[model samples]
Target: MADTLQREHAGVIPGSRAAVSAAVDHLLERQDARGWWSGELETNVTMTSEHVLLLAFLGLPHDDIRDGAIRHLLGCQREDGSWGLYHDAPADLSTTIEAYVALRVLGLDGARPELSQARRAILEQGGVAHARVFTKIWLALFGAYPWEGVPSMPPELVWLPPRVPLNLYDFACWARGTIAPLLIVISRRPCRPLPFSLAELVLPGTEWRLRRVEASGPFAWADHLQKQYERLRIHPGRSAARRRLVKWIRARQEADGSWGGIQPPWVYSLIALHLEGMPLDHEVMRRGLTGLDRFAVEDDGGWRLQACMSPVWDTALAILALRRAGMPAHATPLRRAVEWLVDEQIVGGGDWQVRCAPGTEGGGWAFEFDNDIYPDVDDTAVVVLALLEAEQTDEVRNAVARAQRWVAAMRSSDGAWAAFDRDNVRQVVYSLPFADFGAMLDPPSEDVTAHAIEMFSALGVRPDAPLLAPAIAYLRGAQAPEGSWFGRWGVNHVYGTWCVVSALAPLHIDDRAVSCALAWTERVQNHDGGWGETCASYRDPSFAGVGSSTASQTAWAMLTLQAGGVGDGVAASSGARHLIDRQSAGTWEEPEHTGTGFPGDFYINYHLYRHVFPLMALARYASTDA
Candidate 1:
């Protein structure tokens, strides 16, 4: 078995022990003194629930914080007694099942009425058979599902050439990192049955085979190619594949025991190692356990998943927003945040290079570790805006100038600004099955472009500035025929339209464009005084102007109107009132996850965004007559 594994990955260079040790050291050093490790900004109930599961597995007491989290979990349950990706999202069977399992582990009895409520929700939503592909894999590990139900994941595929049509590299970087260790586990197929059965929760007449086929369609080509190269259910070749996969996993394990500074891969890697007979005392196991500490954050309200780090992205934006909202440039909070931002700037390359390519020579910072591969225009632009808002000390001035030059260099030929690079013009790759992301292929989004325009315009780059014409053209082209623009990084059309109006406000673009955008926004304003659009908006333009009213969406709408000089005091004040009314004591209430930068497919509710934006909107509206 070991021999076959070695042959399968013969070309792979397993990391030297010395190199792995150094990587682990680097990861550990990055941990905050508070004994928590959090960098990946995962935005789902699964993240926080998993954190609780991990802590419980590590023997942490179920304290008040755990209770609070449990309550938070309970609060999100749908009428059907299930949970989903976001608060207001329709209940997803997969997330509901996982949350139910986690709650049961926390001492909730499945036979209890509340537990039965969740079980019933799961059953009604098509039960385990209807859950996601990953959920099935997890269930298989616990003998809740048959191993054969899962699609075969041959470890030998790791040796395929990068140029191969369905090679691992074809996957998004995050997907590849996660699927690596997962392949190892799938190859092993360890099943430890729970004491009870979930058969009662399974839907009537549901066929797991059909469910499997449906879920694999997005990556069916890769699965098919992998199967064609390797036979299934053959034990003779399995040992070698397992050993080779273990070696591959070991090589990529970051210094702190994380696979790639992300949770999905890190958790899978730890589980894989555990299955390999690596005891809890093993240095690898210890490192994996300790690595989770980096992600733990504790505040007065209790602990929650960070979704990811915010130093470069959050601090920069916070500084800039405060300045824009009239906070003094030299205020202590602004200065401290700026100092953190300036220090956090990446001076070298990062993983973004994989997408943008090396030698593109752009500038900006990423939101995570060793993320120097590409400097995002959004982060860079925000940093420039922040630095410009800081007191113009010689050091601050120098940093501002450097960031400005970098932003200028990253401008696309279309005269717009993309998130990471200037001319990443590979559209063909985006059509691949694995590219589930909506904006993964684009050069620039309206949200990011508008941000760039605002920054450049403020930097004294006028409407006639060389970079301005193409940007304006891109903005005009991006506007929907219905007059609204799509927001790639915010809620939906309202966010996009608001961003365009704000960007055009300083330029004093003719009222024709402004009126068009403003009219679209006013049209979409819900009777509830907030605005929202579902993830469906991304796929169907008809749904773009339609979503439930949400606090964050309301704030976005109000901010847009205020920034556009719309001067509808009644509307602005009413919207602000709605937002204020939604506040839970002063903190904005969590309304469905409106903060998602990626909707439907990948939902996120920035914990801070729920409060900060509404605060900004209310403060601004209250001060203005409008």
Candidate 2:
């Protein structure tokens, strides 16, 4: 394989082995004493700002936290005086609105220069009237936006069955968790007093109405009708529905006191429960608020909040990267990581079981420390692959068996996989007026399916196995004419192409598809001998595989080239050299948001991506026979 590919390109870059060793040391040094690895999961300023807002809504004394968050928000402001969804992106109206309001709530006067600039930017973007629905809801909580203008999500939505259209289950798990609590918030329409009015933030003559994104003719009308229904004071099933929603929300709270193990749902759940008369001192609210302390990260710069944590996901990937870098299963770090992962495996029922095949034994892993209710297939598949490289003791073997069975049973009707749910492909949820936030459906995505395929292949499943055949066809059909598969979870084409190519590499099938994808990866290689893609690619494909080179994305392309059996090829060598040249004291520094939450709407800078991925790429290069 190397001989043919070597002739097609060039040889591997020098110093790869030393670079791998340094990266290995860097990663191992960061491993927790508890036998796991995690990095700060950074989103945008919205997270920190929302933390302040949540604290304020609960009337909790948060002087210290508020001071830190204010500093963090100030630091995050761009030259034009706006906060964005990701680093170096254009100013987002909603993000700026939230940050500006958070600063106000934190005691920063509107006359402060930073707040003034942010105010100017908000006005330039059409002010509060143009912000997203969620942002408006946050404003409504403080009487800054009108509750009548916000989209309606009746708690009665819980009454709908799974078989019904536009039911609660139709929304993606993240969205579902958020919407469930939001139902109570909307119905209650609780408004706390703001010390200062946001009159300066709202555009004059603009009414508090839905923007284009929030208005979908019929859905908008339905929202209006729902408001009318509320005004009429109809009391049919309101109490019953609120009880069910409260029960639903409470049942899903993780051990860490977060609902769905995410910030949006967690914060909203606290507010919803509080509005429903749950006191802050109550166990549920106390745990919920106390758990948030874990998500808050304070550094020399300031304090910021992670949108979510990723221990299992990071540990699994760290294990894979170490194993690829020649760390034996017997090595202390590897052994400890494997043990932590085994202990972390969720063996109980979760929301995934709702749509999962009946009798699918429970054994999956979530990204967070306690998100047992939502163990995603992506993490589960990665965990299974990592465990395969371990010592495989009886415990490991049994855990892997159950996980593999759960994964197999979770396969979608089309024989592919989604991140969270199985066969969760309902599109009607997207048509709802309130669904403009982000993706509402957890449909099968190419990157996730690729991971599933790769996991099964690692377990000795043949390329032609009946179980994998349909999945292979799914990937083939999912390929774009230009040869890149869409990355549903990562940044863009580079991530998806890497996933598909690497997954199919061991199978030695799809030669033509692989060739086309290989050409695409090489064609997109940056002049710096690396690869990158902007979050904008999620909005427009022309930006795919095009941006300033980053450690993580460059690693994705390098791994793709190597996986296509061209580890010695010119493109692979260039990418390897790029990684080596960019290496610092031990690891690489990446500020780009390489991970996707809701694509264009939200992005993540998985702080560990800058470390683990580059090491994995460099190690594979050092070990390649080329």
Model 2 C-alpha lDDT per residue in residues 335-404, reported as the tens digit of each score: 9999999999888898788886677778889999989898888999999999999997999999999888
Instruction: Estimate the Cα RMSD of every predicted model relative to the unseen true structure.
Output: 14.1, 2.4
Error of 1 at 428 (Å): 7.8
Residue 517 accuracy (lDDT) in model 1: 81
Question: Any runs in candidate 2 off by more than 4 Å, and if so which?
Answer: 1-12, 208-214
Q: For each candidate, what TM-score against the reference? A: 0.77, 0.97
> Per-residue lDDT tens digits of candidate 1, residues 1-626?
45533432232223212222332233334434432222334366676676665554444455645666666566667777877776556777877887776676566677876678999889887788766667777677667776655666667767766556445555544566667777777777777655566667678787545334343444676655655555545556666766776776776666556665656777788777777777778888788777776676555434555544545665565554455456688766667666666665665554344434346444566555534533577777767776887888887776666667667766777788767655555554454432433333436778889888888887888887777888988898888888888887776787788778878866886567777887777788887767777666765788876887776677778888888775344456557556655655445556465545444556766555555556556555544431
* Alpha carbon deviation, residue 192, candidate 2 (Å): 0.7
Could you say which candidate leads in lDDT? 2
Q: 156 in model 1: Cα distance from truth in Å? A: 5.0
Model 1: how far is 320 from its true place, Å? 2.8
Residue 291 alpha-carbon offset, candidate 1, angstroms: 3.9
Candidate 2's C-alpha lDDT?
0.88
The CA lDDT of each predicted structure is 0.64, 0.88
Best by TM-score: 2
